[model samples]
Target: MKQWLRFLGPLAILAIAAFLLRDKMPFLAEGYQQVLDANNVGLVLALIVTIGSMFAMAEVMRLLLMAGGTKVSLWKTAELTFVANAWSSTFPGGAAISTVYQYQTMRKWDVSVIVSSWFIVVSGVLSTLWLVGLGIVSILFLGASFSIWPLLGSATVMLGIAVLVYLATTHPKATSRIICSEVRTFNRLMRRDPERWIPAIRKHVRQLHAVHLPRRRFALIAALSLANWMLEILGLWLCIWAVTGALPGLERVGENPSFLGVILAFVTAKIVGTAQVTPAGLGPVEAAMTASLVAVGMTASSAFGAVFVYRILAFALMTILGWIIYLISVARGGMKAGEQS
Candidate 1:
């Protein structure tokens, strides 16, 4: 049943994408061609920046784990991280895939599951905050408009900050509360005899609370996380620069609420071909983005060239790189195969 769902999910997503794009596809096709034609060798430079900065994300993870007293080397940890990354960007439920795979990989390196979860959770929370910032920046500079979803983005950041404080200061107790609230029912359903699950959970929670991170390490983690965020945004900025000679300011970029609205609509497009799933966010991103542009008092097609090129660099190109890294890991037996565990 699980296997069946996995297969169906992508198919379902693609089918929906096709239905959405049945109308303005020619324009989408034209946009894609325009993007490709506008590309220059400089994109490879952006790719290099993206790839290098992306790898730096691994360093951030390593520092988090180290703070918890797990002594894994940075380079060794990054190798396994590569595979974890590959799965997440390319697969549905990829987040879970990366989580479980990273835990298993770390175990091979003699890292405990508790420590592994800490590293994973920390990296994710920090990374998410960064993503929110990037999203905001993207909007600010976007030649399109996005919905003024109240303080939705701000709320998300604040909640994440609260969670981080909880994790850093009063972790075990807070984490347990969150888990119980979120997953208590799932726990009951998974077993013949439902267990409170607190004692076991508390064990890890206590470990988290007890773990001491030095001030230097904490600062390092914060810095690296910030760097990771800036690098990717810089990559996006560079991509736009490539297509258009000048940069669009924050107000200009944040012009697309429609783009924002339709993102979740076709987000699952990766599995479906662009025609079906619109992997490039082809028609879906464009239409939504165009609507967003109009919302911000911008003109559609006036910046069509910039929008298309930006998507190519930000989404399509990075995903392609992710796939390449995945394939390399698979062929090498395993990322950790030859290395000492």
Candidate 2:
């Protein structure tokens, strides 16, 4: 049964994605047709930029692993990051699956469970923090006089990140105490003995503190994460330019969906899509992005076209590549090599 599920789960996810994307099929076709007709150079640039984001993400993972006392090659880390991200974006409960896969893969490399878990947890938090940072920057660049809501949302995001970073870094012991106590409470409610798990939790917390990243490492991770997001946004920009026949620049501000406006729209749509109610945030993301573009003065057709192109290149293409790499590596005794990574 487990084997069947493991095989069928991805197929099921793909089926669902197809079902959800049916409405956008026409737009996707049109988008591709437009690109071909225009013979746009921007599309190629966009692809390169989007692919670069994956490399940047891999670096972030490699650095985190190194901090945990394991040194993995850049290519190996990149492969794992790509596969894990693809799995997370493709399946229901993908985030959990991705975490488990990453943990197991790292364990194969002889990384301790505690370090693996820490990397997973800390990296997730850091990534989210940077995403929030991007959203906030977008809101700011779009100008506060434009919308009160996004400004407020950005402020809230900033505050949340500050609190989380503070708790995780400056107050690790206190944070651990709170988590341990909460676990004990939950265990009591479930009629399970808290003693069995409490000690383990404390030990893990101590290990996390011992391996806590220094300021320089933290800055490097933040920069890489931010660059990854920026590259993705740039890809969206190039897509819009490919369809509209005008590459909007930051200096060309003054309304009518300027470059900053497009970026703001992209950031807004991404936040909405982060809910991930659909696989890889497909339906909600497209809808949000299309709406945002139209609101910023793009024609509905152009908005849809640009968004479809960006999604195809950034999300779908990456997933396909990741799957290919995963399959090839698995056949090449990659599981054992993962440890040496």
Best by TM-score: 2
lDDT of 2 by residue, 55-162 (tens): 998888888888777778888888998888778777655777778998899988887777787677666666666666665665677653445565467557756765
Q: Can you give the lDDT of residue 131 in candidate 1?
A: 49
Global lDDT of model 2? 0.74
Cα-based lDDT for every prediction:
0.55, 0.74
Task: Tell me, by lDDT, which candidate is best.
Answer: 2
Residue clash pairs of candidate 2: 72-341, 109-339
lDDT tens digits by residue: candidate 1, 156-255: 7656764675464545676777776656677667763345675776666667764566778767876787786566545544554555443445333453
Summing lDDT over every window of 10 consecutive residues in candidate 1, give the lowest-scoring window: 264-273
